[model samples]
Each structure stands twice: as structure tokens, then as C-alpha cells.
Target: MFIDSDIKEFVEALSSKEPVPGGGGAAALAGALGNALVSMVGNLTVGKEKYKDVEPEVIEILKKAKELQEKLLSLIDEDAQVFSKVAAAYKMPKNTEEEKAKKQEALNQALKDACKVPVEIMEYSLEAIKLQRRLAEIGSNLAISDVGVGALLLKAAVLSGKLNVYINLNSITDKEFVEETKERIEKISEDAEKLADEAYQIILQKLKIEK
Candidate 1:
């Protein structure tokens, strides 16, 4: 699995011409790394006397972050799998009218299928961004910088996923599906942007970084 591979291997494959590990997979990885940081901050905060009053909340955030981390990681493989379908569809024979029709239909379906994993990645990254905002509020003070980094990564994931979705949508023929997916992307992207910025600002103020 791509997830099981080392970073160097994954990056090398990503940099290669092979299409399985593309932007969608990379987006999922970014979100997973962001959630990992969120979980780290929560782990550092929980079971600490300094944060006892908020330890319970931090524990809950930790659970959610871990869940998101797993989901995003799984999407790394899933994005690759679905995108393979897209690649296969693209290679379908289109020499004749009948073949052309079949190829177009297959490509449409493959594009739709390929969109699913990136959309899920964006949705999960939004949730992760929300968690980072809360974690930044109550997580270990020493790890606040991690929260900032997490927020930035999650934001990148969301935007990256957005681009992947749009690219697929451009080729999809079903206007209804395209419109609905675009609407969902708009809402999720907006919320992720806002929450990520809020979390970053909180981290900056906590660090007492001057504007």
C-alpha cells in the first residue's frame, strides 16, 4: 500500500510519471500529517496537571484527531485506487462510433468515481481543521506551534482536494452531479479556510509573535 511505503519511496513515486499517487493522494497525506500533529498536541496535553481542567476535552479531541488521521491515511490508498479506474477508462478503445460512445461513458463514470475520494478527503480535512482549532485552545502550550503547522497543512489539503475535484468535474457530463459537488466543495472549502485561519491566529498570539 502507498501508506505503508516510506516517505522517500512515496515521494519518489509521486514525482514519477506514474499516475496512481497524484494530487488526490498527496492531499490526503497532507491532511493526515496535519491530524497527526493535532493528535500529538492532544497527547502532550492530556494527563498533565497544568491542563487537568481541560484534559477531558483534550482527550476527546485526541480521539477525533486519531480517527481523522486513519481516515485520511486510508484515502491515500483509495484515491490511488479510484484514480486507477480513471486511468483505465482513459485508455479504453475509441476507434469507432460504438467504441467512442463506450469510452465516453466509461470515462464519465470513472471521473465520478475518482471524485469521491478527494471529496471525502476535503470533508475529513475540514473536520480535522475544526479539531485543530479546539486543540489549539486547550492543547499543551509548548506544542501550540504544532497547531499552527497543522492548521496550515489542513488548509492546503482542503484546497488541494478542491483542485482535484474541479479537475474531475470539468470532464463529467452529468450537470446535476457536477453542480452538487461544486456546492459541497464551496461550503467545505470556505469553512476549512476560516477555521484554519482562526487556529493559526490563536497560535500566533499564543506564541506572542508580532505582526
Candidate 2:
């Protein structure tokens, strides 16, 4: 997983003619970054005299954001690994009837597993966006910009995740599964966009009317 590679190596891998750390991995990282920003806002709101009334609420949001962030961070690697598995399944031998059947089964299972990872990312990122909206309202005023950053990151996550969903949807042979997954992805995309827009507007309003 080479979790601690230097910036140069990571950038090289990301830019090199490789596809492992593609859209799915990027979406996972974006989602994690979004949660991280929300966590920062929540942490800054705690233990401040001016924000005492909202301290308890901020504490809860911080806890939840940290949990979500950890999950999403882990998914960054999981998404890449799942994609690699799908690629490997595609390389299965298909010479004989038995080999063809085995390849088909492997491809089907691999596609399903790959879809699950991005679907999970989409659901969690959607929740993170909702939390960012709430945090924008009661978080530290001084740190409202970070809430805006969270909203942006979540929007990136949503769009990036959609790309992963689109790519995986192509491999699915079951018509029902394809239709259902497409519907779910569409709904999530709409909701995530709306939430991100609302959060951004709130940030703008807060900054514009700052006393």
C-alpha cells in the first residue's frame, strides 16, 4: 500500500501511465479531506467562551466527523485494491468452455465487489456534506472558511465518485443491477450537489454580513 511514500513518488505514481489510484481513490481522499476540514471546524469551536452554548454540539459533530474521516481514509487504499482486483479478473483465461465460464464468474464477482467500495464512499461523503452544512451554522466563526473548504472537497468527492460508478456500471451484465445502481448514483449526485451549494451559500452569507 506504500502508505508513506514521499510527495514526489506519490505524484509520479499519480501522473505516471498507471490507473490504480484513479477516480475512485481520488474520491475517497477527497471525502476524507472534507471530513477532516469539518473536524477542524468542530474542534476549533470547542472550549471557547463565546461558543460555549454550542460546545456540546460541536463535540458530537467532531466525533462523528473523525469516525467518517477515518473510514474514508482507509477506503482510499481499498478502492485502489478493489480496482486492481477487477482488472486482474479481466485478465483471466478464456480459451476453453470451462475457462470462459470461470472468467465470466470472476468478472461478475469482481465487478460487484468494485461497485460496493464506491457506493460506500458515495453514501459516507453525502453524510459528510450534511454535517458540513450544520457545522457552518454553529462552528467557530473564525473558521467558517474551513467549512467552505469542506463543502468544496465533498463536492469533488461526489463528482469523482460518480466517475467510479460510471466505470463500474459498464462491467455489470445484469440489467436490473445496472438500472438500480444508476438510479442510486443519480440520486446521490443530486443530493450531494444541493447540500454542497447550500453549505457554500451559508458560508457566503456569514462572511458577507460579518460584523
Candidate 3:
């Protein structure tokens, strides 16, 4: 698993010619790192004299942020696995009509699975960005920049996930499925952009206040 490797090893593996740890895995990893930062900001905010007023909320944010970090990290492998399945499906033999039908069926299902994995990743990224928005509002001023950085990372992850979704959707023969997935992707992409920008601006404003 990519997660089992050390940082240098993971980078080397990702840099290799293998396609398993491609854009999907990278996006999930980025989102995981982003949410970790959000958790750190919440942790930094929750136990301080100056931040007492927001401590309760920060504690809740910290709890959820930890959960999200793990969930996004898990997606890294899931994304790669599903994509691999799709790749394998494409390589299946299709010399005969029966074989062609079987291959088509497998490819359709694999593409759907591949699309779904990235959709889940985008969902997680949205959640991380929302947490970051809350952190920018109530997190400790000392680490507010972390919240901004995390929010940006989450947004980038969402966009990356969207790319994977679109590519899969284009190959899917089910128009209904493609349309449905596209709708969700568009909404998440729009909202993620809005929330990320708002959260980042809040972080910057907080830094100015601190000055």
C-alpha cells in the first residue's frame, strides 16, 4: 500500500511509471494533509486562556477533523484500487461477441466504481474545507494561517478529484449515470470554491487583526 511507505519512498513510488498512485491518490493525500492541518489548528485553539470562548467549538472541530483526516487518507488507496480495476477491465479479452459484451459490462462497472471513488474523495474534501471555514472563524490566531493553507489544499484536492470524475464519466456509456454524477460534481466544485475562498479570506483578516 502507498500509505505503508515512508515519505521518500512514497514519492519515489509515485514518481515511478506505475499508474496506481496517480492523480486520484495524490489528490487524496493532499486532502488528508490539509485536514491534518485543520485538526492541528483546532487542537491549538481548544486549550488556551485567550481562546476559552471558542474552546468548546474548537474541541468539536478537532474531533471531526481527526475523523476526516483518516477517511481522506483511506481514499488514497481506494482511488488507486478502483482505477486499477478499470484499467484491468479495459485490458480484458474481447475477440468474440460474448467476450465483447463481458468486457463492456466489466468496463462499465469499473468506470462507475472509479468515478464513485473520486466522488467520495471530493465529498471528503468539501467536508475538510467546511471545517477549515469554521477554523478560520474561531480557531486560534496563532495558527490561523494553517487553516488558510489547509482550505486551499482541500480546494485543490476537490478540483483534482473532479478531473478524475470527468474522465471516467466521459468513458461511461450510461448517460443517466454520467449526468447525475456531473451534477453532483458541479455543485461540489462550485461550493468548494466559494467556501475555500471565504475561509482563506477569514484567515488573512485574522492575521491582520493579530498585527
Candidate 4:
């Protein structure tokens, strides 16, 4: 699996001309990395004597973070597969009227499916943002910075995922789908940025960093 591959191989694949491991996949992977950091902070908080009162809550957070991490990791491949289908649809022969119609139909559906991969990424990334907000409040003081970093990583995922969504949305002829998706993405991006920035500020305050 792509996720199982070493970092160097994965980076090479991402840098290659192949379209599968493109922006959508990269967004998912970034989100996964963010969630992993959240999980780390959660784990670090759960067994500490200083955090005993909140151990249960942190444990629950750890479980959720792990689940999100795995789901986002799987999404890396899912996004790639969806993009491959879209790419193949685009390459479909259009030599005749019937063939042209078929290609258009395939491309439309494939594009919509491609849009879905990034939509999932945006949704998952939002969840990561919200999760980070909680961790910033109760996570281990030593790893509070990780919670902030996680939030920023999720923000990157949300923004990059939106780029993938917008590109596909532009080619989609479904007016209702286009408008609804645009609205949702706009809200997600706004919420994500605000939450991430707030988390970072809170963490910096907690750590007494003047910067």
C-alpha cells in the first residue's frame, strides 16, 4: 500500500508524473500527520499524574484521534484511486458522437467522484481542527505545541483539499451541486482557519511565548 511505503518512496511517487498521488492524496496524508500528532499529545496526557483527573477524557480523545488518523491514511489511497478514474475517463476515446456522449457521461461522474474525495478530506480536516481545539485546552503542557501544529496541518489539508474540490467543481455541470459544495467549502475554510489560529494563540499563551 502507498501508506506502508517508506517516506522517500512516497515522496518520489508524489513527485512523479503520475496523477494518482496528486493534491487530493497529499491533503489526506497531511491530515493524517496532523491527527497522529494529536494522538501523540493525547497519549502523553493520559498516563501522567498531573493529568490524572482528565485521563479519561484524554483517553477518549486518543481513541478518536487514532481512528481519524487511520481513516485519513486510508483516504490518501482513496483520493488517488478516484483521481485515477477521473484521469482515465478524460483519456477515453471520443471519435464518434456516441463515444463522445459516453466519454462525457463518464467524465462527469468521475469528476463528481473526484470531488467527493476532497470533500471527505475537508470534512475530516474540520474534525481534526475541532479535535485540536480540545487538546489545546487539556493536552500535556510539554506537547501543547504539538496540538497547535496539528491544527495548522489540518488547516493546510482543508485549504489544499478545497483547491482540488474547486478544480473539479469547475468542470462539473451540476449547478446545484456546484453551488452547494462551494458554500460548504467556504464555511469550512473560514471555520478551520479561525479555530487553528485561535488554538495556536492559546498554546503560545500557555507556554508563555512572547512571539
Candidate 5:
């Protein structure tokens, strides 16, 4: 699995011509990194005397962030698997009229399946961003900069996931599916962008950095 591979191995694979560890996998990784940062801040704050007042909330944030981090990491491999199905569908036989019809049907299904992982990546990244926003407000001051970096990573994940969705949507012929998926992506992207920026700005203000 891509997740089991070391960073050097994964980067080597990603740099190669092979398509599985492409944008979808990269986006999932970015989201996972962002949530890991959230958990880091929570961990540093959880047992500190100064932060004891908010320890309960920090513990809850740690739980959610860890869950999201694991889910996003798993999606890195799931994205590759679904995309392989799409690649295989493209290689389907299309010599005869019947063969062409069968190939098209298989391709359409594969395209839809390929979209599922990226959509989940976008949705999960948005949730992670929400956690970062809250963490920025109450997380450890010493680790506040990590919150800014985390929010930025989550935003990148959301945008990257949207692009991956659009690329597959371009080849999909189902009008209803294309329209609905586009709507969903648009909404997720809008809210994610706004919330991520808010989280970053809060961090900037707390650090006394000029906007």
C-alpha cells in the first residue's frame, strides 16, 4: 500500500509516470498532515497547567483529529485503487459496436467510482479545517503557528480534491451526475476556503503578525 511505503518511496512513485499515486493521493496526504498538526497542538496542551481549563475540549479535538487523520491516510490508497479501475476501463475492448457499448458503460461506471474517493477527501478536509479553526482559538499559544500551517494544508487539500473531481467529471456523460457533483464540490470549496482563511487570520492575529 502507498501508506505503508516510506516518504522517499512514495515520492519516487509519485514522480514516476504511474498514475495511481497522483493528485488524489497527494491531496489525501496533505489533508492527513493538516489534521496531524491539529492533534499535535492538542497533545501539547492536554496536560499543561496553563491549559487545564480547556483540557476536556482539547481531548475531544484530539480524538476527532486522529480519526480524520487516519481516514485521510487510508484514502491515499483507496484513491489509487479506484483510479486503477478507471485506467483499466479505458483499456477495455471497443472493436465492435457491441464491444464499444460495453466499453462505454464500463468506462462510465469507472469514472463515477473514481470520483468517490476524491469527494470524500474534500468533505473530510473541510471537517478538518473546522477543527483547525477551533484549535486556533483555544489551542496552545506555543503551537499556534502550526494551526496556520495546518489550515493552509487543509485548504490545499480541498482545492486539489476539487480539481481531481472535475477532471473525472469532464469524461463522465451523465448530465445529472455531473451537475450534482459540481454543485457539491462548489459548496465544499467555498466553505472550506472561507473557514481556512479565518483560521489562518486568527493565528496571525494571535501571533501579533500584521495581516
Candidate 6:
């Protein structure tokens, strides 16, 4: 696993012609930012005089959001590393029949692993969007904008994850595996869009409308 410093170097690599920190890495970062925004809303609601009755629940939400954020941040590196592995597998020598079969198997497995990571990212980001919607309804009035921000970030994550899934699907040779992944990604993307739209409407209704 890459450390924080390594992640910085990875981002610099992204700035060049590198492909590892492409869509997959960007999706992970979007998910992390979404989770972090949800944590911010939770923190803002906790220990406040008006929100005292819900303070305990806010604390729990804050803890969970923080944990998810940390996990998503780490996934940024994980996604890049897995992508690099897939690239390496593709580059393996295959002059002999046995070596060709072995390299193909390795490439297939690497592609699967790469696909799974982005799927996990999409799932986690959808969960974060759900949390943002809930918080927008009951969170501190002043912090509703943060909930909106969370929703937006999750939307970005969902779209970014979809891009990674599509790219990986092009490399996958298994029909069943590709079909299953496509179905799952479609469902999650639809749900994420709905959640983000609802969050946007709620925030506008709550904070932007003139009383």
C-alpha cells in the first residue's frame, strides 16, 4: 500500500502521461471528499445547544463518516496500484504457448481485481450520498450547504467510478462477468443520481427559499 507521500508522488505522476492515477484514482478521491463532507455536517451538528437531543446520534454518524473517509482516501492508492498491476500483466512475455496461457490468465485476474475496486468505490459513495440526504433533512440548518456539497461529491464519485468500470469492461473477456458488472453499475448510478438530486432540492428548499 502506498503512503501519503507516495500518494503525492502518484498525483504528480497523474499530471504527466501516466494512466494509473486516471479515472479510478479520481473516483476514489471524490468518494473520500464526499465522506469528509458528510463528517463535517455531523461534526457541525454535534455538541450544539439546539441539537443537544440528537448529539449522541450525531457523534456516531461523525465517527462512521470519518472511518469511511479514511478508507476511501486509502483506496485512491489501492486503485492506482491495482491498475498498474493490470498494465504489468498485459506486458508479460508470451512467446511460448504455456507462457501465453499464463499471461492471459494473469491479465484476466488483474482486470477483475481492478474492476472490483471501482465497484467498491461506487457502493461506498452511494452510501455516503444516502447519509448526506438524511443529514440535509435533520442536520443543523446552517450546515445544510455542507450536506449539498457531500451530495455533489458523491455524484462525481459515481460518474467517475462508472468511467473506470466501462474502461475495465472493455478488457474483460468473460460475458457473464461483464454483464453482471454492467447491471450493478447501472443500478448504482441511477440511485446516486436520484439521491444527489433530492439532496440538492432539499438544500435549496431549506436554505434558499425566502421565509
Instruction: Give the best candidate by TM-score.
Output: 5
Instruction: Report clashes for each candidate as comma-separated counts.
Output: 0, 0, 0, 0, 0, 0
Q: Write the per-residue lDDT of candidate 5 for residues 24-126, one digit (tens) a residue.
A: 9999999999989989888988899999999999899989998898899999999999988998999999999999998889999999998999999999999
Q: Write model 6 residue lDDT over 1-211, tens digit each, in one string.
A: 4336566776686677867667787888889888888888888888789998878877877877877787788888889889888989989999999999999889888999999888889988998888888888778998898899889989999888988888888987888999999999999999999999999899988876653
Model 4, span 147-209: residue lDDT tens? 988998999999999999999999887789899999999999999899988899999999899
Tell me the TM-score of each prediction against the true structure. 0.97, 0.92, 0.96, 0.95, 0.98, 0.90
Clashing pairs in 4: none
Q: Which digits, one per residue and each the tens of the lDDT, describe model 2 over residues 1-211?
A: 6245665775677777788776787788889889899988988889999999988888888888888987898887888888888899989999999999898889888888898888888889998998899988888999999999999999889888888887888977877988998899889989999999988989999899553
The candidate, 1 or 3, that scores higher on TM-score is 1
TM-score result, candidate 4: 0.95
| Cα RMSD of predicted structure 1 | 1.0
Task: Tally clashes: model 4.
Answer: 0
Instruction: Kindly indicate the candidate among 2 and 4 with the higher lDDT.
Output: 4
Which model scores highest in lDDT?
5
Q: Compared with the true structure, what per-residue lDDT tens digits does model 1 show for residues 87-155?
A: 899999999999999999999999999889899999999999998999878889989999999999999
**Model 2 quality (TM-score):** 0.92
Candidate 2 residue pairs that clash: none
For model 3, name the residue pairs that clash: none
Candidate 4, superposed: residue stretches over 4 Å from native: none
**35-69 in candidate 3: lDDT tens per residue?**
99988888888779998998888888888888888
Model 3 segments beyond 4 Å from truth? 209-211
Models, CA RMSD each: 1.0, 2.3, 1.9, 1.3, 0.9, 2.5
The whole-model lDDT of each prediction reads 0.93, 0.86, 0.89, 0.89, 0.94, 0.86
**Candidate 2, residue 115: lDDT:** 88
Q: Which structure is stronger by TM-score: 2 or 5?
A: 5
Q: Give the least accurate 10-residue stretch of model 4, judged by summed lDDT.
A: 17-26
